[model samples]
Target: MTEKTIFPTRLKNNDYKFTVWAPKARSVRLLAESPKLEITMNKEEFGYWSLIVSGIDAGTRYRYELDGNNSFPDPASLSQPDGVHEASEVIDIHDFEWTDDEWVNIPLDRMIQYELHTGTFSAEGTFEGVIARLDYLKNLGVNTIELLPVAQFSGFRNWGYDGVYPFAVHDGYGGAKELMKLVNTCHQKGIAVILDVVYNHFGPEGNYVSNFGDYFSGKYSTPWGEPLNFDDTNSDEVKNYFLQNALMWCRDFHIDGLRLDAVHAIYDFSAEHIMKQLAGKLDELSQQTEKPYYLIAESNLNDVRYISSHSKGGYGLNGQWSDDFHHAIHALATNETRGYYEDFGTPEQLSKAIKQAFVFDGLYSKYRKKTYGNSTKNNSGEQFVIFSQNHDQVGNRKHGERLISLSSFEMAKLVAGCMFVSPNVPMLFMGEEYGERNPFYYFVSHLDEELNRLVNEGRKEEFKTFFDDKGEAVNPASEEAFERSKLSWGIQKNPEYQSMYNYYKKLIELRKNHPVLQVPDKDKLTITENGKGFTLHRWQGDRQILAFMNFDQNDTELEVPFNQSGNMDKILDSTSTNWNGKGETSPQKIIAGETIKVAKEAILIYSN
Candidate 1:
C-alpha cells in the first residue's frame, strides 16, 4: 500500500545528481560556492535537465543557472536553510529518531482539538517551544493539536497561509529537526497532530515554480493570486507537487492529519480532482503504515461530497471545518448579525446547525442572492469539526477580538459547553481555555513596499463599510497591529482567567467521562427550545444526561417533556457561584416534573 518511492535509494556517491525541468532554457547548469564547480545538465523531454557532479553533497549551497542569466532555487528543494533569495540546502529525511509505535487511533468523535500557530503559541515561536507546554495541553484534555501551516514563507513573521515552499519547514521554527521533534513529542503524549496546509495558491513572493513551467492557470483566479493550474496542460506535475507535499508531512514528519485550507477556492475542472487524488494517496499510506492518517478540508461549499467516502462517489475526506456550525453559534453568542451572519443568529438556525451540522442546506442566501450549500443531513456529526471561534473568525475581524473579549465570561462558558457537548469534534483556539484577551490579527513581513501598501489599503477599504470607525481605521499591515496580536500568557496566572480555564477543562473531562457525550449519535441527541432557554438531551445505555442553557439575561424556567422517575443528580454547571467561590463542595439536586430554573447565561448538565 506504500506509495512507490520517488527516490528509490539514498545517493551514496559524493556527487550530487541534480534534476529539474527547464524547457524554456537552451541549457541549465548547477553552480555551487565554497567548493566552487559547474556541471552541465543533459536536456530531456518536457524541459527536464539533470547533472551529477563529484564532491557535491547535502548542505552544499547550489543554484540552477538558466540560459546563463536567470538563477533560481530547486523546485523540490530538500531544505531552504537560507532564505529563498539564497541558494538551496539539501538534507536527508532518513536522519531522525522516532517513537510512538504503540499509539492507537483516537476516533474523530473523541477528539478535543486545539488549534495553534507555532510562531505564536509560545514566546520563542518555535516547535521546541510548543514541546515545553505538552503537560498544559494534556491537563486541558486536548487530544489533537492542529497547527497552522509551518511551510517556508518570505520572512520569519507570517500567518503561514501564504507559504511558498510546501516541503521546507520555516527556519524560524527550528526547521526540519524541530518539526520532527514536535510531531514525535505530541505522539508520545497520545496527542494527534494535524497540519493546516494551503494548497489553493502560493504566496506572491519567493515562488519559483512558475519559472519551471506554467504552474498557474490564467483560466481561473483567487483573491490572493492566480489559481493553481489543476485543469491546464502539464498539470500532472503541478498537482503532484502538492500531493507529494501532503504525503511528505505524514510520512516524513509523522503528522497524523492535514486540514486543507480554503478548498472552496481550489478550482479544478479535471475529471479527477486534486483533492480526490490526495485522499486516495492518503488512504494507501494509512494502510501501509497501519496507522490512521486523516484529512480535514476547510470548505464552505457544504457540498457533502467533501466528506463522503470515495466508494460512495465523493471526495473521501475524513471531515471539514464546519463553518456553518461556527456561523450559527457565533452569531447567536455575539449577537452580531451582519455579513454572512445574516443567515444565522436565530435559535432555529443555531439549533439546526447543532443537530444537523448545517444551517443552509440549499437554502437561499440573501447576501449572495442565490441558493447556497447542500444538505449535510446524511453526514454524521463526526464529519464536522465545530467551533465557537477560530483563527479566521477572530483575525479577520477589524479588531481581531476573541470570544471572551466580545462577550461576558458567562457567555464564553456557555458557548464552550454547547460546542464541547455537541455531536461534533470540538476545536479550541490557542489560549482559549484562559480567555486570552490578546488578538490573533493577520500579520506578514513582505519586503515589497507596493504589495504591503496594497494589502494595508485593501484591508481598510473592506472594513470601512461594515465595522465601526475604530475597527475600520487601524492599519492591518502596521507593526503595532501585529505586536498587539501576540498572546498574553501572563493571563494564565490571573484568577479570573484561571477560573475560565478550569471551566473548559472540567467540560472536556465531562465530555470524555460521559459515553453519550463522547460518541456523537446524531439520532439520540435532541434540542428543544423553551423561549429564552434550551434543553439538550442525550441517552447512553440506560441513563440520560440533560443539558440546559439560558441565553436570556434573566432567570428562566424550562418545563421538562420527558417522564422523570429516577433520582437525578446535578453533574456539571458553568455558574461560578455554584462551587462556593472556588474549591468548595456544593450539594447536588434532583427534580421531578417541576419548573427548572436556569441561571442567566449559564449551562448545567444533570444525570441520574
Candidate 2:
C-alpha cells in the first residue's frame, strides 16, 4: 500500500543520494551549495537522472541544472527556504522530534471540523502561530482543523490552491519545521489535522515542472488552463509524483487526513483513474500507520461514486464537501437568486438536503439545464460534510459577503443550529463561530505582470454574466484586498459576538454529549415543510429530537410530530433573552399534536 520513496536526494553516511526525473532534458546536473559542488548526473532508463555525491547532508541547499545552464528548484523539494524561485533545501525528515507516539486514530464520526486559511486565521500567518489558538479551538469544540492549502504558493498571501510545489510547505506558514510543530501540537491537544492539497493544476507563477518533463497535458482543458497529465505518456511517473506528495503529507508530516481540491476539474480519462490509484494508496497508508486516516474530496459532481468503496468499482474516499446543503440553507436564509443560487431557494430543497444527502440527486438541474447527481446508494449521511459557511461559499462572492452581513442575526443562529443538529459532520469557517464580518476575497501574487493582469480580468469576466456589479468589483491583485481579508480578532470579544459564540459552543456540546446527533443516518431522519417553515425529526431507539425553524416574518404556531406521542422537552431555544432576542418562553413540554409558538426566524430544538 505504501509507495516507494523517490527523488528528495537523500543524504546517507556523508553522501547525498541524488535522484530526479527529467525525460525532456538532454542533460541534467546537481548544483549543490555550502561547498559549491556540481556532479554530472547519469541519465538512467525512463528519463531518471541520478548520482550519489559526497560531502552533502541535511540542510544542504541545492538546485537542478537543466541543459547545463538553466537551474530550477527540485520538483520534489523538501523545503524551499529561500522562497519558490530560489534553490531547494535538502531536509532530513527524521530530524524533527515528534511527540505523537501515543497518538492514534481520530474517528471520523467524532469530528467537528473547523476550516481555516493559515494566513488569515492568525496575524502571524505561520504554522507556529496556530499553536497559540489551540486552546481556543479545543475549547470551541472543534476536534479537527482543516487547513486550506499550506503548500508553497507564489505569494505570502493566497488561498493555498495556487501552490506549484506540492511537497514544499509555504515559507510564510513557518516552513516544514513549523508545520511539524503544528501537527504535533494538534495531536497533543487531542485534535486531528487535515491538510488541503491541490493537484488539478499548478499556479501560474514559478511553475517550472514542464522544463524538466511533461507534467501538464496540452489535450485536456480546465478553467485554470491545461490539466495535469494524468493519462498522457509518462503519466505513470506523473501519478507516482502526486502520489508521493500525498504519502509525504501523511507519512512525513503525520497529518491525519487530506482534502483534495476540485476533483471534478481534475480531468483524468483512464481505466485506472488517478483518484482511484491515490485512494488505494491511502488505504495502504491507513493500515500501515494503524491510524484512521481519511481522504476528503471537494467534488462538485455530487456523485456518490466519489466515496463509494473500492469493491464497488469506485474511489473509496471518506467524504466530500456537500455544497448542496450549504446552498439550500444559504439561499433560504439570504434569499439570493443569482448564479447557482437561482435554482435553490426553496423549502423543499432544504428538506431534501436534510433527509437525503444530496438535494439534486438524479434530478434535472435548472441552472445546468441537464440532469445532475447520482443516487447515493447506501452512502451514510456522515459521508458528506455539511456547513453553513466555508471559505469558498463566502470568499468567492462579488464582495466576499459572509452570512452575517447578508442575513439577519436570528437567521445566522438558525442556519448554525441546523449545522449542529443535522445528521452529518459539521464544519465552521475560522471566524463564523463569533460572527466576524471581514470579507475573504480571493487574492494572489504573481511575479508575471501580464499574467497577473489576465488573472484579474478572468476573475471579473466570469462574474459578469451572472452578476451586475460582481464583474466591476475590487481588484484582487492589489495589496489592500489581501489585507482586507484578514480576520478582525478584536471584534470577536464584543458582547454581540460573544452571545452567538456561546450559543455555538453549547450547540457543539449538545452534539458531543448526545448520540442521536452524532450518528448521521438518513433513514432515521425526516423533514416536513409547511407554509410557515419546516420541522426536522431525528430519533434513536426510545429517544427522539425535533428541530423547527420559522422563516415567516410574523410569529406562527407549528405542529410537532412524533410516532409515539409524548411531551417533548425543550433543549435550546434561540428566541430566549439569553441570546439577546425576544424573550418568549416556548413551552418546556408539548404533546406530539400540540402547537408551539415560533418567533420570526426563530430556531427551536426539543428532545424526548
Candidate 3:
C-alpha cells in the first residue's frame, strides 16, 4: 500500500486505524481520552505500530504510551485543540463539503503573491479572518496569497515557524476545518493559497517527536534546532512522515502549492535527495488529480540545481525565491551598508540583478570573505520569485522596520516599479500596497519561561552587527510586540495611503495588460547602468517597454536608448502629481537621442 493509505490516523465508518512509527519502543499502547478505551498495538515490520479501535468517532482525543511508562501526543496528529503539550484530537479530513472541483491552480509564472501572517493579518487572527479579505486581495490584482506556516505551535501567538506538529493545524487558527474553508473561499474569489512549511528543523518548545523514535540526527546541527534524520539509519519511514504531510495539505485541504522554508538547512546525503523525492510525489499527485500543484523553495545559495530539471541533475522544483534581487534593491533604497548589505548598494549591481538572475554569480563577496553563488543565466525568469520585502527582511531587523517606515514614500513607489517591471514574478508583503507602517516583529508565546528568555537574548545577539547601539531589542515574547504587528486596516482610507494603494493597482494592471511585461524571457531584456540610476529596455517583437529608474537624491539627465527616429509614449511616472509626487519631471512623449530630466527617487515607464 502507498504512504497515503498506510500512514496517518485514518477513520472509516466509526472505525480508526491508529498507526505510529516508534523504532526504539519495546511496546506501544493507545490511550483514548474520551469514551475511555485502552488497547495494545501490534508491532509490525519497519518499526510501525498499529491497532484498530471500533466505535470511536471524530473528535476523540488520544495519546500513545510507550513501554507502559511514558505517554506522548501523536506525531502525525491532525488537530491539537488545547495545545501542543495536550492530547491530540482525531479529525475526519474528508468530512468537509468542498465546492472547488472546477477550480484549477494558476500557473506559477503568472502569480502575484501577497504574503501574510495569520495572527497579524486581521483583527480576528483566525482562518475566517483571512477569508474575509479575499475579495479585497482580488480587487488589488493579487492572484495568490502565501500564508506563513499554520501548523500547531506552542501557543496562541507565533510566526508559525516554531510548529511542533506537522500534521495538526494550529488550534488558535480554528483547526483543520477552518483552513479548508479558507482555501475553498479563496478559490471561489479567483485566488490561490500557498502555505509555508518548515521541514529543516523543529521548534524548541513542546517537541516530543524525538521521544518515540530517532526523529532527529545528532550528527548534524542547525542554528534553529536539531536537524532531521534524513540520511541516517532507518530513514525511510522518516522521509515518509514528511511526504505524507505535504500530500495531506493538497489531498485533504486542497492547497495549491507549498513554499519550502530554508531548504538549504535540510541536511541530506542520500543517493536520492529528499527534495527530488518530494517533487516526484507532487508531480504524481498533480497528474492523479488533473490539477497543477507547485513546490517552491527558499534558498540563498544562488544555485540553479534547486529549480533545474531532473535530467540535468537537478531537483525539478517549480520556483525558488531570489534573495539577491531583494538585497540589491533594498541596499540601494535604504543605503545602510551593514551586515549582508555590505555587498550591495550600487547601480551596477542593481543592473546586473535585473538582467541576470543573480548578482553574486561565482563572485567574491566582501561579507562572506569568499566566492559565493553559481550563475543563473541559463534559467528562465519564471523560475524565480522576487520581492522587495518579506517576513525575514522586516522581522529580522532590530526594530522590525518595514520599507515604508525605513524609507520615504517616493522611494517605496520607485522600488515597486523596479519589481513589477522585472521579468520575474513579483510578491508584495501584506499591507505594502496601502503603505501600511506596522512593524512585523518576530514574536512567539512559548509557555516555557526559560525558552522565552533564550529567544529574546538570541534575537538581540543576532542583530548586533546591524545596529550600532547595544540597546535592548523589541521583546519577541511580549504580547505588545504581537499586537503591534497586526495590520491597521482603517489607515488605508487616509489620503496618502489611498494614493499608494491606487499606484500599486495601476502597476499590476500594466504588467497584466502589456505583452512585453508579461513575458519572463530575460534574453530579450537589456539593462544599461548610468550615473546614479539605470535604464531597462525589454521587447517582445514590436511590443517594447523602456524604464528609467533614478535612485539619486537630485535630478539627472539621461539619454533615450531607442533608435534616432523611434517614438515612445510614457505610461507611468512615479513622480507625477497624481501619485502624490512633487510633479511630473519626465515628458509624456519621448524621441530617440533626446535627453530627458528624470526626477530623483523616481521611476518612469514608457511603451511603444
Best by lDDT: 3
Error of 2 at 113 (Å): 0.3
Candidate 2, residues 1-608, lDDT tens digits: the string is 22345556445475667778899988998899997888789988777888888777778888999887899999888778777899998877767899998999577878899999888888877777689899988998989999999888886768887888888888878888889999999999999999999989998787889998888988877787678999888887788889998988998899999999999988788788888888888888888877777999998889888899888878888899899999998898888888899889988988888877688888988888888898875888778899988988887887888998998888888889988888888999989988888888888877667877897888788778656654466677788778898888764568778888888888899888776887777789888888758788888888888888886655555544444487778899987777767776678877866666677788898898
Residue clash pairs of candidate 3 = none
Which pairs in model 1 have colliding backbones? 23-47
Instruction: Mark the 10 consecutive residues where model 1 has the least summed lDDT.
Output: 1-10
lDDT of 1 by residue, 1-608 (tens): 11222221136664456777565678888788768877678886555677666765556777888888888887766678778667877666767888878875577888999999888888888999899998899998998999999888887778888778777788889988888988889989889999999999998888887887767899887889888888788777677778878888898888989999999889888888889999998889989988888899998778889889877778899999888888887887788877778777787787788888888889998877888888777788888998988889998888888988888878888888888778888999998888888888887877676877887888877777556566454565577666777678775468777787788888999888787887877778889887756888888788788888777654443444434667568888777553213221322666666556667777778887
Instruction: Give stretches of model 2 more than 4 Å off.
Output: 1-4, 9-14, 470-472, 553-564
TM-score of each: 0.94, 0.96, 0.98
Cα displacement (Å) at residue 324, model 3: 0.3
Number of the candidate with higher lDDT, 2 or 3? 3
Q: Flag the better candidate by lDDT, 1 or 3.
A: 3
Instruction: State candidate 1's TM-score.
Output: 0.94
Positional deviation of 566 in candidate 3, in angstroms? Answer: 2.2
- TM-score head-to-head 2 vs 3, winner: 3
Candidate 2, residue 144: lDDT? 96
The RMSD (Cα, Å) of candidate 3 is 1.5
Colliding residue pairs in candidate 2? none
lDDT by candidate, in order shown: 0.80, 0.84, 0.88
